[model samples]
Target: MDFQTDKASLKIIRNKKLEYELPFLWIRDNCSCNDCRIQETKEKRFMLNSIPADLKPKKISINEDALNVIWPDEHETIIRFQDLELLKKSRKPEKILWTNDFIPNNYDWSDFLTDDCVAIDAFSEFIAKGAICISNSPCILNSLEDLAPRLGPIREVLFERIHNVSVDGHIYNIAHTSLEVPPHNDFASYSWPPSVQALHMLENECDGGKSMIVDGYKVLSDLKNDHPEFFKILTTFSVPFREFDEENETFANEPIIRLNSSNEIIGLRYSNQLMQMIDPSKKNLDTFYKAYHELCKRVNDKKYKSTFRLEAGNILLVSAHRVLHGREEFKPSGKRHLQDAYYELDNIENNLVLYKELRGN
Candidate 1:
C-alpha cells in the first residue's frame, strides 16, 4: 500500500488498479486524531476557522495500520485505511428510486412482534424503500402506542401520541372530513417535521379511500433532470408553511426540496393543506407558480403514485421525509378508523445497525 499526493487530492493507491482521490481539503477536514478529534468521544475538536484556506498536508507516511500525515501547521494526524474507506462510503447512502411500478416488501407483524430478525428486517425495509406494509397485527385501540418504541421513541406532535383517525364532524383538520386528501407530507409546517409515520388500520369497511403515496425523491429527481431551472429555484428558495387550529399553530419557512452540501436531494417537506401564502414581491409569482404547479402535478401524477387498500390490522410505516401520503374520498356509510403515531428515522436506523452488529452481519 502507498499514500501519494497529487496537485489537488490525497491519493490512496493500494495497487495499480485500486486507488481513490480524496480532495486535499477533505482529507485535512476529516482528520480524526486525538488532537483533531476528542479521544474519548471521537468527536471533532477542531473548528473550521482553525484551518487555513490554502492549507495542505506537509508530509504523508504509511505507519503501522494507519496513514500518518503532517499538516502545514506542524500538526501530526493519523487515519486508518479502514476508517477512511468507511468515511468515503458514508458520504451518501446508496440511493433507490421508485415509482408506481415499485412494489415494496411486506413485513409480517406476527414475526416482528416476536422475532428480533423480523423486527430488524421490517425497520430496514422502511429505511431503504421509504415505505413498507406491515400485515397481521392486532386491530385494537392504542396497540400502536404499545409497539411504537419498536422503531424509536414516539415523537410528540401537537396531535395525540396515538392519534385516532375517523371521520367525525369536526371541521378543524381536512383529515377529519370524508374528502379526498391530496398527496403530501404531514406536519410540514413544523420547523423539524416528523421523520417517520406509522399508520395502523384498526378498521376500514369503506367503499373508496385507498391509501395513496407518492415518492417525493423520484419526483424531485425527474424535476432536476428535466427542468433544471425549476429544480434550482425550488432548492434555493424557501416557502411559507403553516398549520393552525383552535389549539395548535405551527409554522416554518423551508424549501420544498432540500439539498445537502454536494447539492444532492436530502429531504422534502410538503403539505398542500399547510402551505401558506407566498409573498409575491419576495418571489416572482408567475415564475414561482410555474415551478410550484409543475412540482405539484408531478407529485400527484398517477404514473408516480401508488394506491393500496389498507386492511384492518395492517400498519403502513413510511419515511415521512420523502414520502407523501394521501387518501381518496370514501363513503361515510361504513366504519373507518385508524391509529397513527410518529417516530424518528435515526432511532430505527440505530436499532438496525446494532441488530446487524449483534447478529455479526
Candidate 2:
C-alpha cells in the first residue's frame, strides 16, 4: 500500500495489507461532514458517544488525488493527502505524547503576570514545552484593567476567548465550595483534549488548602519500573466516568485514562467522584489497585509535594495532563479566591512566537 499527498487531496493506493490493517471505525471517525466540524454550533451536530461501531461504510473510492468515503448514514467526505500530512505533523508521537519535551527547563516565568503585560524572553520556551509556573507579586486578576498593556498582545496570539468571572459565578462557587478536591487530572475525560490551564490566584486567607501537584509522567515511570504488569492492566482498561448536573440535566461518561496504539499513557482521567467501579474480571485488579493507591500516596506525600499559598496577587499555570492538582482542606471560615482561564496548547505557542518576534528574544 502507498499513501501520497497532493494539493487539496490525498491518494491511497490500496493493497491487501491496507484492507487488513485499516478499520472502518477509523474512517468513520475521521469524517469531515458539517456535523463533525469542531466549529459547528448546532446541538444535534455534536458528536455522540452512542455512534454504532459495527456500522460499515457504504462505499470507499479513490480518485486521482483523494480518498472519498461514504458512510451508511449517507455522510460523504473527502480526505486530501496534504490535509492528511498536516494532521500527521500535528499528531505527537506516542512515546512523547504526554511529555513536555519541547519546553525548555531553564525558561523564566517572572513576567507572566503583570499589570502592564510584557512578553518575557522565556515565554515561548515555556509554552512549547507544556506548562510554566509564573511567580509575581500583586494579583493578575485584580489588575485586569491594566492587563492589556502587558498581556494584551500575548492574549491576541494565545487565547480563543478571555473573560472574567464575578464572585457569584458558578465556577467561583465550585472553587469555594470544595476545599479538598480528590486526586484527578484536568479535562482528561473530554474526547477533544484540553491542552493548557492557567490559574492566577487573587486571594488566599484560609488556613489550609495549599496547592498540590503530582507529575503523572513520574508516576507512570515508577509503575513501569516496579510493576510493569500492573501498569499494563491500568493502561489497558478504561474506567468509566459520570458527571451529573441536576439543574441542566447534563451527564457525561468517559474513561478515566486512555492509551494510544502502543499502550503508552497518553491521558489521565482521575476524577474520584466521577469514576464508576471497574469491571471485576479484569486481570491484575488487586495488584493494579495496590499500585494505584501507592502512586496516590506518593503524590500526596509531603516530600514529593510543592506547597504554596496563593497570596493576594500570584499566578500559576500548569499542563493539565502532566500535573494532577488539588488543594488541602481549609478552614470553613476563611476566604480563598482564584481566577482561572483555559487555553489550547497551540494558542500558548502562538503567544510565545509573537512575544519572541516583538521582543527579539
Candidate 3:
C-alpha cells in the first residue's frame, strides 16, 4: 500500500487497483483516540471546528497493517487498514427483486419468536426479499404486539397505534369497507412514511379477500430501464396525498419515488386512494400524467402481483418502503378482521446483526 497527499486530501492506493481519496479534515475529525472519543460508548468527542482548518500531518508512517500519523501538536492518530477495508463493504444484504412467481418464505411463529438462529434466517430473508410470512401466530386481538421484540416498537400514527381493518370497524379509510383496494403503502400522506409494516390476520373466514403484494422496487427498476423519462419524472414530480377521519387528519405532497445521495432508490410513496386532486394548471401536468398512467398500469398488472390467502393465524410482514400491499373485495359473508402496525426497518436490520454476532455466525 502507498499514499500520496496534496493540499486538500490524501490518496491511498493498494495493489495498483483500489484507491481512496480522503480529506485531511475528515481523517482528523474521525480520530478514535482515547482523548478524541468516549472510551465507554465509543462516541465522538473531538470537534472539527476546534482544529485548524488547514491541519496537516507532521510525519506519516505505514506499518504492516496500519497508518500512523503525527500532527503538528504532537498528537498521534493510527488508522487500521482493516477498518478501511471494512468501511468499503456493504452493510446490508443485497436486495433480491421478485415478480409474480415469488412466494414469500414462511417461518413458524414459535421459532421466529423464540430462537435467535431462526430470527437471523427469517430477518435475512426479510431484508433481501422485502417481505416474509409467519404462520401459527395467535389469533386473539392485539396479538400483533407480540412482534415488538423482533420488529421493535410500534410507530403510532394519527388514527391509532394498532389499526383494525374490518367492515364493522372505524370507517376512516377504504380498508374499513369491503372494497377492492389498490396496491399501496399506508400513510403515504406522511412525508416520511413508516419503513416496515406487519399485517396480522386475526380472522379471515370471508371469501375473495385475497391479499395482493407488488414489489414497487422491481416495477421501478423495469421502468427505469425501459422508460427512463418516466422514471425521472416520478422521482421528481410531487403529488398530494391525504388520509383522515372525523377527528384526525394527515397530509403531504411528496414525490412518488425517493433516492439517496448516491442516487439509489431508497423509498417509494404510492397511494392511489389517498391521492388528492392536483391543480389543473400545474407545470408539466401533461407529462406527469403520462408517467403516472404508465406507473399505475404496471403496478396493477397481474404479471407483477402475487395473490394469496392470508389465514387467521398468519402475519404478512413487509418493507413498506419497497413493497405495496392491497386486497381484493370480499363478500361480507363471514367475519374478516386484520390488525396492522408500523415499525422502522432500522430496528429489524440492527436486530439481525446483533443476533448473528451473538451467535458467532
Q: In candidate 2, what are the lDDT values of residues 1-361, reduced to their tens digit? A: 4544333233355562332234555555666667676555533343545467565656677655666778777888676656655655523212222322222233223444431134443344343334445555456543433433333322221112343322334541234454576545544435444555556667677677776655566566666788776666666555555443434321234443457888766566566655567679967668768766766665565544445565556555656666666667777555566765554555545565565556664
Best by TM-score: 3
Local lDDT at 246 for model 3: 89
- lDDT by residue for model 1 (273-327), tens: 8888888788566777889889988988999888988899898888898888888
In angstroms, the error of model 2 at 195 is 2.2
In model 3, which range of ten residues has the least summed lDDT? Answer: 13-22
Per-residue error for 308 in candidate 1, Å, reads 0.8
| Reference-based TM-score of each model | 0.84, 0.55, 0.97
Residue 242 accuracy (lDDT) in model 2: 46
Off by over 4 Å in 1: 1-65, 68-78, 91-93
Per-candidate Cα lDDT values, in order, are 0.82, 0.53, 0.91
Judge candidate 3 at residue 25 and give its lDDT: 84
